[model samples]
Target: MNVSNLLKYCALSMAIGIAIVPNANAITPDDQLVIGMSMDNLLSLDPAAASGLDVVGVNSNLYDMLIELAPKDPSQISPAVAQSWTISDDGTRITFKLRDDVTFHSGNKLTAQDVAWSLQRVLKLNLALASTWKTYGFTADNVDQVVQAIDDYTLEITLPEITDPKLVLYTLGSSPSAFIVDRKEALKHEVDGDLAHTWLTTNVAGSGPFQLQNWRAKDRVLMNRFDDYWREPSEMKRIVMRHMTESQSLRLMLQRGDIDVAMGMSIPDIEALKQDSHIRTEANTRGTLYYVAVSMKDPKFANKKVREAVRYLIDYQGINESIMPNYGVLHQRPVKSGLPATLPGPGYALNVEKAKTLLAEAGYPEGFQTSIRVLSQLPFINIATNVQSTLAQAGINAEIITGTGNQVYGAMRERNFEMLVGRGGGGIEPHPHSSLRSLVYNPDNSDEAKLTNFQGWRTAFYSPDINSIIDTALLEKDAKKQIKMYQDVQNLYDTQIGAIFPISQMVDTVLIRSDVKHYEGHQAATTRLREVTKER
Candidate 1:
């Protein structure tokens, strides 16, 4: 299949649908972890082309980047393939000392040349992952010039004159684009100018703890431990990511011992699992967030007061405590809480009177009706329903339209929707400027721009002031002032009413059997299976 068809095939399969029950005859070894959940976001296995927090989690196990984030402390950087790195005082150049023992799954000894090649390929391909690296000032024509290998053990990266050096490392360590692949293995399979995309769509070409053993689209992704991995080998020799979408099937599989771990279960199912003696459920607050977007193209929402009123229409406490229990927290800022440069906004309170008054001031005293598109999956559909009800209480009618992610989110991306309740957050690097870019930065709304990275663009919202704040903060040298710039951006967002982040969510409730051990979620919502072992 071609590239576009391949993406459509994957998207069609991952689109929210009926849950397929796992075959009962399947058996797992004592050292194997058969995880059950809907693998929806994993489109391409190629490190250069793939994107998403789930994709990051899977690719992290397959490819070893020069650096990695300290699991517990996202603010701190840790070495992965590169033992150490140094930045130039000017904050424009960085040099990494690559590890000598690292070897690709293809049995090729990793060289600094390979590291340079992998990064350059991201620029050459210009896929979704490319945004991670492209955010730094390197372009396809100049990436080769910007990225160079000092020697077989040393790789160097040169940045723009005004770029923040820390942002480079944070982007390299956390973004999917940084996952280094085997230089030669990928080219060996290159076809039709695809840069090995056709082959890599389902193959593994990295040096992580686990290697891709098999991938049956819409069914399961089977990965096996890489014995020659540079780090300690995973205790579980294999992991099976079962393609089960329904929360009930996941809960059922966990109860019957069909799957060792069940992730992404609904709130009610998660609560019921707590009562089950055989199941152990863990809920960790992650960097993921849920927010509402008002299309600026819509005349009603174009009014700032109407947008602010919509924010107050949401019952943050009632929604989280009752409908989306443990899914998210009451956070309304553009950035995740506790991150540097993150400043709290005058959070929208649930008050029908307040909403009605704002509506009246916006010249909609009797209120109006609008359509909201959402994914027909757990939590989102439920959350949309709750939002609909709340808006109705304020005399505003919100009709809910449910569809697959491709239909709902794809529409949002194409700028074809008036309003949407979307899930997004990029706080994995602990930077407010970076996270806000995903939520509110829209330098251009032109079709030719196609700047999907900026969610604000999707909602037809654009502001030169906020966009300048994002650009300035990213390149700001002084840490304190950079944070102040971010604070200014948040304050601008509060008054302008571009988007409303009702809450930041934890994202998952993982159910594991008592035998399961050491399973924890990364801030990006990807579960690392290497440290996971069973009591047996």
Candidate 2:
């Protein structure tokens, strides 16, 4: 597709409007306790349709799922609406024992039927939220069937095959895979034939600790504590998320005590803020992989040797030091550390001579020129510029094309660019099988299917042999066996996959007001607002 066509599609996709104000004066009353955030951009407010971190952070407070990750430690799955769960001997079936006391914000009692309906809705919305499934190789199709309530508190789910350990982890944790919504209320505002799935784009009804009170689109989103929430009530009565896109303005707000919390501040600015006595800094290794996706559809990147050479040209250590200093760590596997079995092994090593020779063999002895698309966010832009410098040393002339996060994604979907620098957030799953499948697996003629060919960069297409291995990995019940199977898939990605240039895991530095208490971080780039309470 051409640039004009791509732009037209982007305009259509984002009809919601960009009402963000970067330098607005402090508007919230001092008694209300407002939090300021420097956001990348919110793509959608609908929980099922949300794909970005900013959108997820906001929606997480609005929606509750059947199962939730423990706030203090993400490795364990804790009860939310469900009191407990059970698995079949073959691991093909999962039975959830629900909590009878929980109720949606609308006051309807939570039921087993609601859980079944919610899973079905998630499957239908998977197409629109393909990126959410990339890390776990999960799709709506994995759910072979759903069995309704044996009683008001019990629900059962059966898979077509034995599910892998990572797939199980994803099923229990990923927001897109497990978040539960109210079926009865969602169906009242149905878009197409599916009410639960359709109504989610603009509306929500959940049993979480907080409930969505109002949304002013790009301007602000307000959520209030759920008085009858299933869990203990939050200390804060209301959470007001104001959209700010400028780092300088956010820094000023943090300094002036206008916001209790600030997100996405620049690295240098965060360091400077740490010196202040009133502010406290918290950082965590968010399981995210930042990399470049080169369009393999382009003839220049069609060769395996050429792609491998590009990987060698990148200085992972230098990029981490210069661009991410305190907020990033070089990643050896696509899977981030702190998760299970993500130990370092041989992948790409920096070798300038190898890159030079490979370029020469590809008929670009003096190097060829290409443009890489990047988001306006500081970390992404810095990485892209650093890549340009690295590639230049290997005789390749590369230019950076900067745009909004949505704009850059739009260009990537249309295959209108040669390369794009971006980050792919990992799910709680400890394997790369899901991540690889999402990026490479083709499902009908969907955009995900089209993009799955890695923009046509794979030296050799995904074969039946690889496909069968992935299918087997998904079914393996043993934890050790599952990890072994995933390692096999990672071997294939490290040797032959197209589009991705694996780099590093994300470490986000968050600044919070010293008075804020009970802050708990998530593996994804989020924190539980329900746990936070300000000192009087």
Candidate 3:
């Protein structure tokens, strides 16, 4: 069945609910983490080409980057493949000294050359997520000259003086594009000199803790523990992730102990399971933000006053406390709180009378009717449906359009939709400038501009002043000065209504057996399996 039909079928069955089975497979193997999750598809296994949570959730098990965030704490950065590094006094050059003792799963010793090759591959192949690195001036055409393996154990890269050194490091620390792929092994599998791009999609070539055992698309994935892992191997000897999206199905699987962990559980299911003593639920306040974007291209939303009115039409508190309890927090800032460049969110709440007055001033005295496209998934469907009812109170009737994320986001990217209730931001980087640049601050809004770095381009929202402020904030090396610039941008965000932010940053929750340990959630939903252990 398609997403719509599948969800309907799942909902109907959910009403009947599954009974507690006798053999709830309660005793998971002491050496496995069988995770249950939701995904439309796992497009590619090549880390460079991967974008969604499906791939990111477990890629780290097979790859190691030069630097990475602490699995338990995103606020701090930790060395991975690189033991130590130093930056030039001018902050334009960085040199990393690698760990010679590490070896890839292929039995090939890790080398600095592999690092250079991987970085260049991302730019040359122009992978799906290359834009994240483009912001720091590293491109395929100029990479050889910019990134060099100074020796067998040292790697070096230089940035344009105008680029922020921190931004470059941040991108590298974020994903596998900056990781070391076994060049010798990768080249052997290369077809048509594709840098093994075609081969690696279904293979593993790294020094991380796990190896890709098998992958049957639309069905399941199996990763086996690497005995020769450079670091201490995880207690999990195998990880089995079945392709399951229905929240009810996932909850049932967890309750039956058919799976050790259940991700993407709906709020109602989570609350209901709270009474089940055998299961554990954790809600982590992540950096992800959920919001509604009003297309500036639409004449109805072109007025700033009308956009501002849209913010007050919905009950932020009611939704967080009732509809989204533990799922999301009431955050009104464009950049979520605690990240660099954020300010405490202030007074934007449900004021239906005020919203009606603003609508009248904008010449929509009788209010207006609009439509929003959303994914056929939890939180979004519920959030949009609730917002629709709230908006009607202000005389603005919003019709909810339910579909896959591809359909909804695709429409936003083409500027083909008037509004969208979607969830996305620079939640992974934990930086204010990253969120602001990705969500707002569009200076060049033309077809020729091709600014995928700015989502505002998708919404047709342009603000040159805020754009300049964002650029300024990014370049400031002084932490204090940079944060102040972000605050200034947030102030503009609230006044200009550039985008409507409903929740500060939402969290990801998972239901697991109580014996599972160290299964913390990350903002990107990129859960690392290496550190996870199970109690006897």
Candidate 4:
């Protein structure tokens, strides 16, 4: 269906009431516990438009997916709405059998139809949502069709082509692209497409364990336990999420016992938290990589030798030791640093002498000048300062520009900067296609397909051979073939197309009050309220 029709249907659906107000005294702070976090601020409450930590926090409380990552074992998926799933022989179809008992917080039964409708909504409203489908090598446009209601509990998903393991994993994660919303309820609210964007910006209704009760943007959000939650009931009756923008304020709140958990603290703050006996710290390897996306389109960086020289000049080891001493781990590959069989091979080895030679070969005997823009957020500022100092030692004159996240993202998208330092989150898929699509597949222009081509990366280095290898890897079902193809792509990325420099995938450290419990299964700073509980 066209987007206009979809919008009309959504508006009609939302007009019908889906929410059932809870008893006034059913939930209260006295019956629950509070958690604290540092949020980047949310642009919208709808999972489709969610990109920041605040948005994630809000969505995690309000929405539920068919499948969820098991808390103890992230690789072992578990049932949320869908109890079990089976793959077709050709791996082209995935059939998910929904749990019979699950219902939305609004009291409507969640069925196969809802699941199908949710996926369709994401596919239909692609731009309003995060660009996660790029990793699947299939945008929402590629979802050939979704058939459901085979007895209400069975949902069958038919893709245009064979499904890859990485795609499967991505579809089950907490990412915005995977969240399942109530179709009838969403439509009844008069929110369809972009119009629904504003409606969902601060309101929600879903099957997740927690239900949002209040949201004061840039301040705090309050959620209470969903009494009709299909699974085990949450331990805390309510959860208070205080958005303390300043790290110092968060630190003070934690010390005063005003909050139970504090997330995304700086290295120094984490170190200080360790001194308090009442606080406990947990760190996990984030599926994220910090890198400097250099503009290959620039005349100076167009040469492969120049790109290699820039990569070699980065002293990742020293930066980690000095800036992120306790929480950082050097990353060799774009994948997370701690995953099994995901390490970098000969392609990522560092060599200063080789860098100098490459620089000289690129006609930069004394290196060249470039501007590096960085987000003003903590840790990023420190990291950029370190990068500036390190590049200077290689005779490269680097200057740092600071701006807000939105400003930086816009600048990168507009190709206004020489280099941009940022992390490309959500590359959990093992295949190179997952990373390649984001960096290479530009829907707007075949020439500028890679998202990283933001800095005018149009060059002859866009190799058809590398693209073929990535495509083969995506279609390859066998694990061995996938790895080989991935290796080929990495080798190409490292040696030929010098678009990005791989930095450390540092651990995201979170501090929880000793009295709090049930916060587990976080691979990074990203947390799901469904899996967390506060001790009384």
Question: Each model's TM-score?
Answer: 0.88, 0.84, 0.87, 0.83
Best by TM-score: 1
Off by over 4 Å in 4: 1-30, 52-54, 128-131, 134-144, 147-151, 189-195, 338-341, 344-369, 394-397, 413-416, 425-461, 524-526, 531-536
lDDT, residue 334, candidate 4: 49
TM-score of 2: 0.84
The alpha-carbon deviation from the true structure for residue 446 of candidate 2, after best TM-score superposition, in angstroms, is 8.8
TM-score of 1: 0.88
Per-residue lDDT tens digits of candidate 3, residues 1-536?
Answer: 35664454344234223233345456456787777776653657786776666677768777888988754567577888999999899888999999988898889999999999888888778755666666676677898999999998999999844666766777677754665689899999999868899998888788888888888765667788998887898888988777677777777767766578887788788888889887999877766678877788899888988988888887787777776775677887778677646676686688999999999999999998899888777677778887888889988888888876557876776778887888767766767867776788676788565555457777788888888898887888799988898899888867778854655467677788887888876655556788888885
Give the per-residue lDDT of model 2 (tens digit) for 1-536: 35653453234223322222333333333234455564455765565556667777776777767677665466567777778888777765678898889788888887888777776565555544533433333455554254456788898766544455335545456555356777777777775675455456656777777887776655666777888876788877878777665666666666655567777778778889989887888887766668877876678876777787788888787887778855678875655566454556565667899899988887888888898889877688888988888889888889889987667876766656787887764544445554545444332334345332232212123445556666776666687887787677667667674557767777776777777777766766445678777764
lDDT (10s digit) by residue, model 1, range 166-277: 8788888777777787889989999887778888888988888888888876577777899998888999888777777788767765775667887778888888889988
By TM-score: ranked, best first: 1, 3, 2, 4
lDDT of 4 by residue, 85-195 (tens): 888777767788888898887889988888777666665565434345544444555553544456688988766545574466554564665677776677777544453
Q: Candidate 1 — worst ten consecutive residues by lDDT sum? A: 16-25
